[model samples]
Target: MAANILLTRIDNRLVHGQVGVTWTKSLGANLILVANDDAAGDELQQKLMSTTADSSGAGIRFFTLEKTIKIISRAADRQHIFIVVKTPADARTLVEGGVPIKEINVGNMHFAQGKTEVTKKVYADAKDKDDLLALANSGVKIYIQDYPGDKQYPITDDLLSKVE
Candidate 1:
C-alpha cells in the first residue's frame, strides 16, 4: 500500500482530545506530523503531543518548518498523513519556501483580536484574509474545514465572487 497524506491542516490546538479521539479515526490517519518550530522545540509539549499522536503506532513526527518543507516536498506515501500546524504564518512559510502543494485546509483558526468572519469552520481575521488571497492568487487552494471530514469552502470560491 502506498502511504499518502490525507490533509495538511492548520490548527493551534494540536493533538487535543478531539484530535486524539475523533479526527484521527474519522480521517483514517496513519501519521501525524506536527510541523511547528516552537512545538517541536518544547520537550514537554512534544511528549504530550506524542501521547496523543495515538497508540496505534501510527508514525508521529515533529519537524521544524525548514525541515518539514524539505520532507513534504519529497515524501510519497499512501498511508494517510495528518499534519497539524499552529498558525497560518507557518502555511505561508511553507508555500513561500516552495513546498509543492496545491491546496491547504484551514481548521479552527481561533478568534483573535483582528477583523472577523466565521466563514464555515474557520474564524478569519483581516490579515488571514489577505494571506489567503495571496496564496489563492498563487494557485493554492486555501479552504475552511474544522475536521478532515468537514465540507470545505475553497478560497477560490471567494475569489470568483469578487471578480463577479
Candidate 2:
C-alpha cells in the first residue's frame, strides 16, 4: 500500500501551476484535498478553480476537510494525497478535530496585517504561532517551506526563538 496520505501543506493559492508542476510530482500525491469551507460553497469560484487546478490526469478534490475526513479515514486502497489548508486555524482545527497529521508544510503564509515578526520566507501571526505551538505540543512535525524542494524552516524554533 502506498502512502495513504503524503503531504499536508498550507498555501493560500491552493492548486496553482507551480504546485501542480512541482509539489504534486515531488510528493507523489496527485490527489489533493483543498480544505477550505468558504471556497467549497461558491459554486462559481469552485468551477473556476477546478479549471485551473485540473491537471487533466491528476485527481483533485476541492472540499472542506471536515467533509472529507471520514472518507479519507476509511479509504484503504492507498493513494498519495496532499491536503491544502488556507489558514493556520484550518490546519489546527483538523489536528484538534482528530486528523492524524504526521507533518504539515507551510508553503506561503505571506505578509499580512496583525502578523508577527517576519523570519526568512515565513511569517506567523498570533493565531498562526499558537497553532504552531499547539501542533508542536501535540507532536506533529511542521516544516516551513516556500516550495516543494526548498529547504524547510522549522516553525517551532522560529516561534520559540522570537517569542518575547
lDDT of 1: 0.71
- Stretches of candidate 2 off by over 4 Å are 1-3, 160-164
lDDT value, residue 65 of candidate 2: 65
How accurate locally is residue 15 in candidate 2, as Cα lDDT from 0 to 100? 67
CA RMSD for every model?
Answer: 3.9, 2.5
lDDT of each: 0.71, 0.72
Q: What is model 1's C-alpha RMSD? A: 3.9
Decoy 1 TM-score against native: 0.78
User: What TM value does model 2 have?
Assistant: 0.85
